[model samples]
Target: MLVLFVLAFGLFAILNPRVFLNPINLQNMMVASPEVGILAIAMALAMLTGGIDLSLVAIANLSAITVSTMFTAIASSDPATAESLGGFIALIGVLVGALAGAVNGFLIATVGITPILATLATMQIFNGIAIVWTGGKTLYGAPAVLSSVGQATVGGIPILFLEFLVVAVLIGVLISRTPFGRRTQLQGANPTAAMYSGIRSTSVLYGTYVTTGLLGGIAGLVFLSRNPTASADYGTSYVLLVIVIAVLGGTNPTGGFATITGVVLATLVLQVVQSGFTAIRLSAYEYAIAQGVILIAVMVFDQVRVRRRPRRAPSSQTETIALAEIPRA
Candidate 1:
């Protein structure tokens, strides 16, 4: 998939070097990628555990909005305290996200609710809370320090992109190299076997959702920093997009299989395609349509492939009789 993406990107750059290959355009593409990329990774984790998180973007928005409101209130009351809080705003956003994830975990793990229904309900609840808190208005004027992460560059690389890279590496290690990751895979692949093996399935599920929430929160904070504004309706279409990315990156929808490398590379491909569309002056709706088509096609292909696999039949009477005769001889 990465190879295909590289080929497509090369073709585009060759076709329109002035636009697609331009340094500024590349930097802008990187800047645009991190939020969705981060969310996609978070979504990948959930899928690996045989579940989905429909509320990630909602969590992100709520966290960012909450932190933004806190900062605004503090700044209005005491300049010095607000200044100190600015540095801690990101951490506070992550905590908010983790708390939201805990709610999801409790509902699904403790209350015995299905993951899909649980997250679906939470999605609406979180979105409603955000709307009520923000009163359907956008909050702006975050601290300059927080904004710098989105605006500043290191060695011509966007800091947001760098942050994403760090996160991807950490998550990749967690999923591919850690014992916890192995347990998660086992739980997703065969819950009965995992439980029988003394694996605490409930704990794994809780951890997975919480980690997802943390990532969502970080992405939300990044979005807030990038735009320096908080809105209740931010990234309204991202939940589906992240799901598509995760599936495309080889995170099995049925669970028990995923690759962080695939997720990161897939994100780059999408971002490149997005930038390519802009270079050629394509409409934004076209991008959404293309993504939808790709997602549907991939799902269809997976279903077909699964259905095409050979099936094993039960033992026939002739084979059973032959085996019985041999044993008697």
Candidate 2:
């Protein structure tokens, strides 16, 4: 993933040195990346559990819509009040995201629904709810302070981008340093073994989906920060794009492994590619085609690498004999 990011960045820099390398354009990329990057992280978490959350974008939009509507309804003309209320409302948006995630978690963990099917169904349901709430129209207006924070920069780095980095780092630490993370990977790697080891699969899965949903909600808030408008249909194309980012980031679809670093680098790679496309005047369709090619190539590469690696031998002679004695299929 790091190699891919470097190569993509170098290629784009070579192709459009003046535009792609410009400070403003680079800043724009940093600003634009968080929305999708957060979603990609959410998707990665789901993928880590041998599952997927198709409803994440829906959850994000729902959260954003909820935030927007609340702001429009209660916003004060007074700047200070509006700003304070906006901060409160934004927290509500994040909580709304967590609530939405809890719903997905319930359906999957409590109801025994497959993650993909459950999220697919909830995606539509969430979108429907958002549409009904907004009458199928975009809700505009957010707190001035929220927009200011969204566009604010410190030491030339976008605050929004810095927020994304913090999120990524925190999640990375969670995965690498926490017991829940260990259980999550173990559950994905082998559910039966994890069960025998006393890791409750249902609990882990529920927590995983809830966390993803929370991340989705955060992404929605980031979206609002950048563009203070919300609609049920916002970021409709992000569903597949985020999945691509997760897969390209070295997440296993069959579960058991994921890397936050990989996901972040992959996010940057896609961002650079998209920026390059705009620099060279390529159409969106062309960019989509390029994404497809990249996904396919990465899958093929992973397959080849897996096949070439040495497999572990049986640790005990008795186990080897048992394997040798087994009937041929």
Provide C-alpha RMSD values for all models, in order: 4.2, 3.3
**Cα lDDT of model 2 by residue, 1-329, tens digit:** 78888898899899889999999999999999999999999999998888999999999999999888888777645556666788788889989999989998899889999999999999999999999999999889887767897899999999999999999999999888999999999988898999999999889988998899899989999888999999999999999999999889988888999998888988998998899999989999999998998889888998899999999976798798899999997
> Candidate 1 lDDT, tens digit per residue, 1-329?
57758876997898789999999999998899999999999999999989999999999999889778888988898977887878797688889999999999999889989999999999999999999998999998676777888988999999999999999999999998998999999988988999999999889999999999999999888888788899989999898889989988889888898998888888888888788888888888998887777667667887899999988776798688878788552
Best-matching candidate per lDDT? 2
List ranges where model 2 is wrong by over 4 Å.
76-80, 312-329
> What is the C-alpha local distance difference test score of each model?
0.89, 0.90
**Lowest summed-lDDT stretch of 10 residues in model 2?**
75-84
Q: In candidate 2, residue 122 scores what lDDT?
A: 96
Q: What's the lDDT for candidate 2? A: 0.90
